[model samples]
Target: MDVNKTYKGVALQEVLTLLQQHENTSKVIAGGTDLIIQLRECKVTPQVLIDVSSLEEIKGIEIIENRVSIGAATTFTQLVNSPFLNNGLEGLKEAAKSVGSPQIRNIATVGGNICNASPAADIIPPLLVLDSELYISDINKSRTISLEKFLIDKGQVDLKTNELLCHIQFNNIKNNQGLGFSKLGLRKSLAIARISVAVWVEVEENTYKQVRIATGACSKLGVREREVEALLLGKPVEEKTMQLGAEALKTQLEKRLAGRKGMEYKREAIQGVFKEALTKATYLSKT
Candidate 1:
């Protein structure tokens, strides 16, 4: 167990150089919410730790043109207080607030949450529904990945070891859009989600135009329920339509995690959550 000094840097270039020089095994320490736990458990023991906490390059959120770019090192608390998203992206801001606890949110970052790559990651579901894109940067190569492709597996990603996750970017929402988020954790606060659902819908008159619903924790990875979206598209949100949409989403989740041991509880719970989310969104759209 070699802890090769805690090296701190002020610039991104210097951090990148230190990270790249250590072969493909070094881990960058950001908020250290998840990384420190993993390292102490002996699950990961890197010889080099390139601390990026002070690097000014990957911090803060910005609205450039129509796109909303969130820095990799931005804290969850920063997101929870963002005026631009206070109403437009309420679900995302809510999800950030709900992650871990106040203490964790004060330090845990969006990049750290995504990098952990857990199926139940509290933030991934909302980001998926929002259609956020991930920017991954390596010293030699850089690329962008859709939220769907970023989390390739339960604990794996297209992110190469040499690459550092830069940030997540997405477009601003319109006034007609209503957003909702719900999570089934063991408890109310500081609990990891057993299943989480996020829904975003744009209502044109009484009909739904663009709808996005994403489920996490239950599946191998968080993803949008396209089948459910198709049913809700162009359809008026009413008693019958909402029921059908909920059932459709349930069917899709069951198919993905066919033999999951918690299917009995998870399937029933997700349907209820998605239905409530849709109901709330419709109610909000009307007002």
Candidate 2:
């Protein structure tokens, strides 16, 4: 295919204008890590490329009134190094750090990762546990949708061709709550995750008051383990309770991925992933 035009150094407004003009023929590029690969493999052939990587509208992290808003273009390296993410949002930090290598982390934006909608994308599970919402904007209008809802299927998302993902926001966990993430990959470095879990827990005097669990790479789309979360809610935060919760998560995974290749291995691997995430979340809550 042939490229009709490439626009760089454009602001968000101009980018939207170009997208409106080109419609389906236009593609946005931010940190081009994934888009470049798709282009090279002939998976996508856009006549126009709008580079929004440096747009000031989507390049930083902000905290306001107990909520954190991350610009869609924020890189994994930026997330990993943010001081604000060091405390209550450690799960997100861990997930960002677990991405690829330093080079990929530096170049890959969170929006790109989410828009790619890869089941194995490390950032999605943690964001899901946080109940994150994405802000999508187009020339005509703007709207917000939950990250879970925004992700339609593997390699697909609920985004219009002319829309851009602007920001991701989630409430900050309170002192009584903690978030934790764990992933098992084939290799330690530069490896795609085989199984990953993110857990958020609220503890009240040794009992689990509220719980949210999300898993990645174990299903067609990264999803919250609502059954496991319900089973763990109001239960004591102890070894037995955690073990039971893990088992429930395994059952959910088995049901969702039945008869698929590698289902058996993923079902078994989820136990460890859930355990690690739960243990860390519990430990963090206590502190």
Q: Which candidate comes out best when scored by lDDT?
A: 2
RMSD of 2: 1.0
TM-score of 2: 0.98
Give the winner by TM-score: 2
Total residue pair clashes for candidate 1: 0
Over 205-250, each residue of candidate 1 has an lDDT whose tens digit, in order, gives 7889888888888777877888888888898867888888878877
Candidate 1 overall lDDT versus native: 0.81
Q: Compose the digit string of candidate 2's lDDT tens values, residues 136-248.
A: 99998999999999989999999999999999999988888899999999999899999999999999989999999999998888898888888998998789998999889
Residue 21 in candidate 2, Cα distance off native in Å = 0.9
Give, for candidate 2, the lowest lDDT window spanning 10 residues.
82-91
- Give the residue spans of candidate 2 off by over 4 A: none
